[model samples]
Target: MQKVASKRWKLAEKIPPEIEQALSYYPAFFRQVLYNRGITSTEQAMAFLSPGEDFHDPMMLLNMAGVVERLLYAIDHHEPIAVYGDYDVDGVSATALLVETIQLLGGNVTAYIPNRFEEGYGLNIEALGHLREQGIRLVLTVDCGIRSLQEAEHARQIGLDLIISDHHHPLDEIPPANFVICPKQNGDEYPEKNLAGVGVAYKIAQALLRQRRKELPREGFGLDLVALGTVADVVPLTGENRLLVRAGLKELRRGGRTGLRSLAQAARLNLGALSTSDIGFGLAPRLNAAGRLESALASYQLLLERDIQQIGMLVQHLDDQNRERQKITTEMQKRAEELIQEEGFEEILFAFDESFNPGVVGLVAGKLTESYYRPAVVGHINGEYVRASCRSIPAFHITQALDACADLMVHHGGHALAAGFTIHRDRLAELKQRLAKIAFEQLGDLDLRPVLRADVEIPLGELHPEFLKYLYLLEPTGMDNPEVFFVSRNVRTSNARAIGADGKHLKFLVTDGWITYDAVAFRQGHWMEAGLPKEVDILYRFEMNTFNGRESLQLNVVDIKPAGGD
Candidate 1:
């Protein structure tokens, strides 16, 4: 029901006639899309479309040889190894993969996921002591431990061999783990640096499996966990990450993983028709709920569990927890908006709640950043120290910004747009001032307006059943590699109806003289009150809709404006 205003619709460059003639396999609109995405050549297009035969070599990763050697020795000797992981979905999937892969190779391993509320993120001294008490001779961390410089040293002093495999941005000082296997630390020309925790774990799995056998077992064996982590982490869905998801989706559709099958059933998802969106929207959140509300070990166990009744119970718990997570986030968002207003709407927003769930702080920050188009810092107001989640727009690198003020924080790690840290409550104001100054220096002069980039401007008639098939070629779309967008002009709306609870969405029948199409606009129910103008220009994604076993084309309208507006 909320209509966005002041959005900038940027159209893709027009393709020349000669180029279009040569790219007959590509629809004219999609040709521009490929070009915009840096796929200007036929070979580039071919490679993007068909990622076949090869993936990046695991040995090419930094310290991979060391990781493999250390891990192989642990496996052969049957040393008790603790798989340390964070609490998010990326960490959950990576933990599951590492545990299963180690078990498959006849290794002694146990999963150790820190509680979000208790242990917080990454390695802690208390956990190390407990692991040592449990006779953990070696610690293999997935998706975390990159920034645990102190804890890594403590593990060494306590006579535990530590191997860290994480994908987060490294601080200036790397942890003293036995071998840190992250590509970014190499400073070499690796093909892809955007592998999520699970992707990194998958590479380790591939190397271990190939080391143990002559030929690889299967094309995409056990990739469902990899895909779930890759997609859920919101990593760039290009390069090697694309290959992983593309293969993983096939495995997911096969219904081979009992836990995933039970989860899909609980979420009312059809594995046969599973897409990346299903994983992102339905499955990932539930998997993430285990970490956000409770121990991530629950989700980790769900991934490896084969018993039907246990899986059913886990799925039910995850579903319920996900619902509770949603409710908590909604209330937090409301409080965050109020905090924004109280702060007088500064350049960088700071929001905190004494009662806010520390786990959903990132979600709140993400929502606030998207809603206001500014960097948001959402903190869980602990008594003296606070755990804060920061989300930023494309213009600012949040982790880099955190690096600028690293001296003030207990610890921090993340990527460009999202990061987290712990700081004392007393320094909150100074932290705000420091970050605000940096944001002003970097982004104050910019437009700060949200822009929707379109692949091409095409008539509504161009979208047909055939076009959906072409769109199928671009699967597993997410961050970095986005879904296609179209700018359709002179669209006439025949009728408009407000749908959803309390009329929060707009359903319309639109035509551009040549084609009449069904359209759905999310959060635009306000348009129905004005009866929708006779003519308009709409920015939308051409979507294939299915209902009652029938397929048809519909426009998923993103933004609408007057027909002649700039």
Candidate 2:
């Protein structure tokens, strides 16, 4: 690891007086973090700390006018409309939100979530032909169809009207849909650009809500679905997104939706105090497991169903599926690592096997990318074609790299960080060479070491119960506004020992000259080389760890470096 020089924290010069005043309400160390993140003005800080739905204007999104107009026309004519969506949490939730919104608007609508194993992602031409045969006059796609140029043409050829509401990064050419509500579309002026797929669907719902002049249902109508999609899609939780998720989580905890309540019950989570972490780590993976292991339609049906017993049954099945997914993912990860070791890939790693499940390749690729901090691609040889998923670090854009090899791909689309594609089985080796060339060119002369961003630095003496209490104001942290990580130098370890049953976790008591604090380093067994240091520089986040009816402030250790001479 490269060593960074120690320097005193300097607040940004452009910090406004109001922000300084707000800093008076916080510790000086935290104030430094606010300044570093460009939250130097009181207005900016307040907005960042407390976001609301008012931050976004639905009208600002491109194609909103056209989408709303066409939807209203469909409602007026009572056209038979199909809500076509992908199978993941975002796709399912987007489909549920839009179907509910349109149904409330008196539109004849039915939802169709593509089967992961049979139909795959986005609009399949055969599915569109089937919908046409079913006499579906209009189709609205959510969370997909941004790059379905040929599929859209097929729909047009079959006399089916199509509207697309997607948030994926678009290619140079857009499909000829009646209206496209993708924020990435050309000339889109929406201020917030990084909306998840479900976020785009929520915007459409917002537009319809405004047009109808109806108050959002106070009984927790759409927020559950919103929360599911926002968390699962891993969109930045800032601005409008933060507001939606905050409100949605509130509704989720209040027990507004049967599906959410059942899911929480099945997962053994406390519905009364649900947090973003719970949603991301606990619920999302379970919901996504169905799509990955079996049928994403199970998740979609669970969210939309009104029957309580049915919801419970589906939750049980999802829980089981999630356990299975964990097993499969673990095995795939081991195999992927072995492949990398055997291949000795220095800068980029590419692995494929006929035995690899197409559904889990994306997850395996993500794990490999994080493990090595390199551009990683995992694919499954599916008969004549190879379905692949690609994940990249912050320094690389995987989708753009895939686009460069567009001629070699049958279909592909995704964001800069993650993407997926398909190629003829015979072309796998050539595609791997092409991808490695692109990665080498783009990553040349760039440092590939992982960065753990510390929000602030403080003496261990400053960590107190009162200070940890004040930190609660920064709850529900994820994506853009992450949990605050503080670095403390020259901290002496009073005691350290393995804590967990399998010795996977490490517990320690650390102290400065004036004060002592409890700390826990999860999954740090491998890092416990030699004896624990008496004094170390610790990077950690303050969290409330509860166990055995005890609630106390704890340092969640991120990284530890040997302390220099005091």
Candidate 3:
């Protein structure tokens, strides 16, 4: 196993006096936390903590007027429509959201999610032709097809009307579809640019519902799906995206969706008390497992299933598949790490082999990036072609780098920090060389180590149980909006022991002389082998832990080091 990389802890600067006075009613810690998130005034803090559903007008999206008009006309004319979606959680949930919206609107609609191993990502000529043959007159994509320039032309040639709705970063030129909905596209003025694919679909659903205001099917019906995809896609939880997820969490906890309820039961999560962490670590992975191992159709169908028995069966299958996925990811990540150790870390890491499962290559690449704090590309070589997933750090714009090497790739598209591509196996060497050159140009002079940002540094005694309530104000935290972490230095440790089935978690008691609290450092059990230091510095999240009906304050340690060792 590779040694853990030492992280640099950057503490947030103290809040300015004027802003602190503006937020004077709030606790000092909460005020600092809010300021750290760019909340300056009382209005901004109030709006952030208790956001109202003042969602932006969906019509603001470019081409949304035409797309909604076309869709309403299709409903009136009884035209067949297909919602083409990708196979990941974001894609599958977006597919379900739009399909259900059209069905509720009384339009003849069906869902089309291509098999990952077979059709690959995004819109494909073959899938479009198949949909056209089925007498589908219109195709609307969700969570994909922002870069399907050729496929859009193919659809038009086949006399199929296409509306592309995707949140991925588009290339210099977009598809020639009848309508395109993307905030990042040129000439678009949508305020929220970080929406997940399912989010874009929700906007379409909103526009469709607005047209039939008197016959609105339901309120917040699709927000659960929106929340699932938005969180699963790891988009920034801020602005409108934050409001959608907050409302979606409420909808999810209501247990209206049978498939999601069944999934929650299987995952041992209390649906009534579900949080974003549960979605990110528990439910999203299970839903993604179906696509990662076999086919995502099962997941898409589960979301729409009304039968209890069928939902149970699907949830069980997903659970089994998720377990298998974990095994495969662990093995593949080990192999990738071994390869990196043998070849040494490059500007960007690459590990490709025929034996690597295409389904889990992205996961392996993510693991490598996380372990080494660098961009990583892991691919599966199949015959003459290699398909790869790239995970990158902030220093590098992964998609732009791929764009620099476009001539060497079959096709590629994704966000700045994550991307996917396929290239002829023969040109793999040139692609790597070009990509490394691009990465080195941007990242060679930077300090590339991982950073752990703490909102404040204080004595452990100052952390009170009442502070937990203030922390709860920042719910639905992920990606850009993160959970607050604190740095407590010169803390003494005692009763240290390795816990967990694999003995990979360190459990101990920590104190700053006056106040003592139980702390757990996950995956830090190796510290015991080296002898636990009597004095240590820890960066952790302070929260309440309930064990056997007893609730007590606990410190969830994120990183630990010997006191004053730096």
Candidate 4:
């Protein structure tokens, strides 16, 4: 893990007196965290703390006017419209959101989510042909079609109009669509650029609302779908994204959608108190597991259905698929580890197996990259080609590197952090060599260690329900605006014991000079036998733990290090 530089508290430098006074209710350390994250001015602090405000104008997004005009035309003309989306949680939720939005507007609409294994990502030619045959006049793509230059061209050839509302990084040449609403597109003027796929779809929904002069739905009912996809896609939760998720989470807690309620029940989540962590870890995974292990249609159906019985059945199927996905992901991770060990990859790691499922390769590759903090690629070998998922550390841009080696790839596009590509199976070795060389050259002198950024340093005595409540102001935390992690130094573990079913969790009591606290570290059970020292530095987040009808405070350990060591 990366070692963060220690610094004195600097809240006074950033926070205004009024904001600081308002935060006086919180512990000094919690106030410092709020200040450090730029919630310093009165308005900024208030907005961050409240989260109900800070919405962006839907018209601010690029192509909102064009998209709205076209959609209105389609509604007025009674044209058959199709919503094309990708298959992940973000894509499925985006599809559900757009389909429902258009249906509410009285437009004849159908939805399409590409099959991961059969059709791959983006616009598939066969699917487009099928849609054309179904007399779909306008194609509005959600979460995909940004890179489908040829597919879009084919649609144009067939006299079908297309509009793209995607968040993926665009290639050098964009497809000729009727309208495009990607923030990252060159020359676009959207203020919040780093939107998730669902975020873009939500913008489209917002545009429709404005066109009709409709009141923003009560408590943002549409936001529940937005929250699921925004969190699931792991987009940075800052700016407009934070606002959308905050509202969406509120809707989710109130049980806005029956489909979401059914899904939460299937996942055994307590909806009343659901947090971003629960959605990202529990619900999103089950939704995504269907796309990985089986058909994504199940997940889409679960989200779009109104029938409680059908929702229950679909949730059960997804639950089973999630279990199977876990098993396959574990097996794939083991095999990837073995391949890394056998091949002795030093600066980069790449693995391929014909039997590996393409849908799960990305998950496995991500795990491998996290395990080693190296750029890793996991691919599924086919007859003459290989499709792979590439995950990189913050220091490397995998997609740009793939772009550099475009000569060897069939097609590739993604963000700087994660990407996907296809290459001739015969040239897999060459592709790996080229990518490794690029990564090594670019990241040679960089510190590859992962840094755990502590929001603030806190004395154990300062932890309380009030402080925890202040921390709740940073709701819907992900990517950029993450849950605050505080570092406590020179603390001693009073007692430690292995807990949980498989003894894979560690529950411990820690004490500083003036305070004692309960702490739990999941997947750190092996540390129990490592012998706790008298003094250690621990990185942790404050959480409200409920057990047996009782509520108490707990420290969720993120990392631990020797007190005086680097």
Candidate 5:
């Protein structure tokens, strides 16, 4: 188990007085949070808070004209098109988004989600042959196919026109497809370089809408799916992503998609008041469960399903699959932990197992990164090949590290924090040796403890009602931007008790002399067992907790320590 003292609380930097005093119009403490986000001016702050203030030009992407021309040609010619997508939420959502849009523009389209257990990721030769047999004349890949150089060649050989739309780091050699639209491609200038896979797909749809001279669906008809995939992939919630999510959440609150509405009901969520947490923690997990343990078609269909009965069955089945996936993940995580302890974990960790599922290794790597605060690689050894998934810390870029040793991999690509690759099993030892050396070289002197940064240090008594409302102004925060958190010093824990199933959480009554608040710390029940100090400093966020028809502000404590240190 990780030690509790491993956390470090960092106070936000203080800007110049002139900068802070100039923007005295907004809430002071909340404005400080904006300042921390590099917003020194009121205009920047307003644009960040409000959605739709600025929109990037979709046509600016490199080869946007070619992408539009080929796709439009297929649509006009009435040729069956395939949207080959990954099984994860981002890929599936992009597939659904594109398929629906093409159908709206009168085109024959089918979505294909590669089976994780069989095809792994991206294009496979056998799937291509099948698509050809199914009369798929043109292929449009959503969220995948960037690195399928050889497969793209084979598709052309078989008389298939392939258009790839993906958002992953490309290797030296680009694919041989007709048109590849990725922000990372050379000469591309889409402005926001950090769009999720679904975000890229949405841009294509938006471009197609403009090409047809049609008004964008007022609700961004496809935007709800955008929000689901964007949050699920954990992309930086800034730039165009923030605008899309801000609007998507409003659309989700309307509960228009029958399948998504059923999913909300099945998850026991209030559909009318959805938030980022509902998508990331609640909905995205279920959607990913389908891809992890079963064929992702269930999720892809769920996104488009209008039949209420089928939607209910699909959600119930997905919930069951998610439970099984969780159990397997727990077991694998325990084994991985044992291996890490046995080997003595370093700045970077590598774990391999024949039994590890390729579909779930990313999740395991993510868990390992969170628990150990280090970049991690978890892979499944399949015969002579190992398909590995990597999760990274903010201090290190795992993809760049993989790039440094790219020759050994069959194909490797992904973003900074999360990536995947396939390599010969024999190269595992060399890869480990090379990566450990890189880790030491890159992170030898840097502290690895997780740092929790608070917006400002303020007394609990200073939290006025208006200030709480102002906090909501910074909604849909993730990645680069974070939710509001404040530090309160010298607080007394009036009462502390273990709550939740098996007493895994700490329910406490906290006070700062002037007022008392009901506070709960999830997954921190050990604090109660160790016994809280008489006086302590706490990092917390306020929330409106509803119980028994009553609503009251509650302290969602983030971290705690003795009054002087954290």
Candidate 6:
């Protein structure tokens, strides 16, 4: 069995006296939590906790006017448009949103998602040629094509109008599309720079809706899709994104879309009281499983399906695929670790095998990074080329490292912590060496242990049911905005035992001398092997768990250690 590594606990710094006083209207605990999120004044705290409905003007996005004008012209002229998209959730959601938006506006549009195994990611010349042959006069790309210089040129040569609306990091030489919408591009001043691809598509939808208010529905049209994609992409939930998600969650809980409503039921989720965590762990995985295993068109169709029977079939298919995906991921992670142990760990971990599924390699890379606390690259070596996905820690920028070795790669583009690339199998060794050099230069002296951060340190006795109200304010928390975690020391433990079917989870009772509370530690059943400690320190989230319609307060322990043991 693999030994559980010790984690470093880092308590958050206390708020400044002045800022704390500024936010004195709230309770001290709430004030501290707000201050931890960089909220200094009363106004910022209110806005952070309860975001407003007003969004940044969609017209602010660069080339928005041109793209809108061209799209409107296409709508007016009845030009056939193709919504070209990638296979992931972000891309699929963006594609669905844009396609639905255009279709609702009396435009003729169809979705064209690239196959993961056949066409790979992003825009491709063959797809553009096919679209042109099918008489698609205008092509609108979502979640991809920001770096498709060659594909954009091919579209121009084929006499197809192309508008690229993506949120990925763009290359120096932008794609020569008819119009481009990316906030990160030079001279673009859209305030929310960290939008997911679906967020970008939502902005375009907003722009179009502003022009055609007569056709607008009573409630927002695509906010549910926006929420699904935004949370799934794992972007920072701050600024405009937080506002979008807050509104989107409200929209999602309304259960307006039949497919989503059925999906929630199929996943055993309460659609009426959906939370961001529900979307991240429950909905996103099932939606993404379709693309990871087969084609993503099923997910897209499910999102737009209105028939109850069709929705049920699709949801059941996705659930089965997700289960299969989970099993494959476990096997792949075990193999990756074995390969790494045989060759020894390095600054950057690389595992490539022909047996690795192209769809699930990214998930394996993420798992490796979490287990070893280093940048990891997992790939599938096919006939002549290899496709790989990467995940990294904060200390090293994986995408920038890929950029430094751009000459060896056929294509690569992503954010700082996640990326993917394609390379010739012959040059794989050289690419690995170069990336290792870059990783060492950036991370040579850093201690690489995983650090678990807590918002505040308090005794277990201080937790109360009423405090849950304040915690609710931090709803839709993810990425940069995290949930509140508390560290309790020297808490007495009793009634400890392994609880899941596989005995992988721990259930116990914790007490701070006078007060006792039920606690559940997920994936920490290893501690039961040596008998439970009499007393231990725990870092956990205080939450209310509802089981069989009974609500009870519980500590969702994230990590635990023997008291005073380093």
Best by TM-score: 6
For model 5, how does the per-residue alpha-carbon lDDT over 141-201 read when each residue is reduced to its tens digit? 9888888999999999999989988988776778998989999888787888888899999
RMSD of 3: 1.4
User: What ranges in model 1 sit over 4 Å off?
Assistant: 1-4, 16-18, 21-25, 187-189, 214-219
Over 1-566, each residue of candidate 6 has an lDDT whose tens digit, in order, gives 23228788998899889999999998887888998898999999888777878899999999999999999999989999999988988999999999989988999999999989898998999999999999999999999999999999999998999999999999999999999999999999999999999999999999998987746664868999999999999999988999899999998999998888888988888887898999998999999999888899999999889888888899999999999999999999989888777656467788999999999999999998888888999999999999999999988999999999999999998988999999999999899889988988888888777888898888787877888999998888999999999999999999999999799999999998899999999988988897889999999999988877788999999999899876
Per-residue lDDT tens digits for candidate 1, residues 1-566, read 12125699888777777766666678776787777787767777888887773788888887777788888899999999989988888888898888888888889999999998998999999999999999999998989988889999999999888999988878768898888887777463557899999999888887887787734345567688889999999999988899889888999999888899989988888788898999999999999998898888789889999898898899999999999999999999999888877876456888887988998999999998888888889999889999999999899999999999988888887888999999988887888889989998999789777899988888777766677765778887999889988888888997799999889999999997877999999988989886688899999988878776788788999999989988
- What tens-digit string does per-residue lDDT give for candidate 3 at 487-509? 99999999999999689999999
Which should have the higher TM-score, number 2 or number 4?
4
* Residues 1-566 of candidate 2: C-alpha lDDT, one tens digit per residue: 11123322321344456776776766666576677666766677667666655648888998898888889889889999999998888898999999989988889998988777787789999999898888789999999999999998888899999998899988788999888888888899998888888888888888887898877667556877888788888788777777778878888888877887888878777888888888887888888999898888788888878898898889999999999998999899888887777666566788888889888999999988876778889988889998888888878989988888999989998887788998998888788788878887888677666677777667787766666654655655678767777888998897788877668788888888788779999877554555778889888888887765577778999777678632
Q: Roughly what TM-score does model 2 have, to 2 decimal places?
A: 0.92
Give the least accurate 10-residue stretch of model 6, judged by summed lDDT.
1-10
Arranged by lDDT with the best first, the candidates are: 3, 6, 5, 1, 4, 2
Which pairs clash in model 6? none
Q: List the residue pairs that clash in candidate 4.
A: 2-450
RMSD each, Å: 2.0, 3.3, 1.4, 3.3, 1.6, 1.3
- Judging by TM-score, tell me the better candidate of 1 and 3: 3
Error of 4 at 325 (Å): 0.6
Per-candidate TM equals: 0.96, 0.92, 0.98, 0.93, 0.97, 0.98
Report the C-alpha displacement of residue 260, candidate 2, in angstroms: 1.4
Q: Write down the TM-score for model 6.
A: 0.98
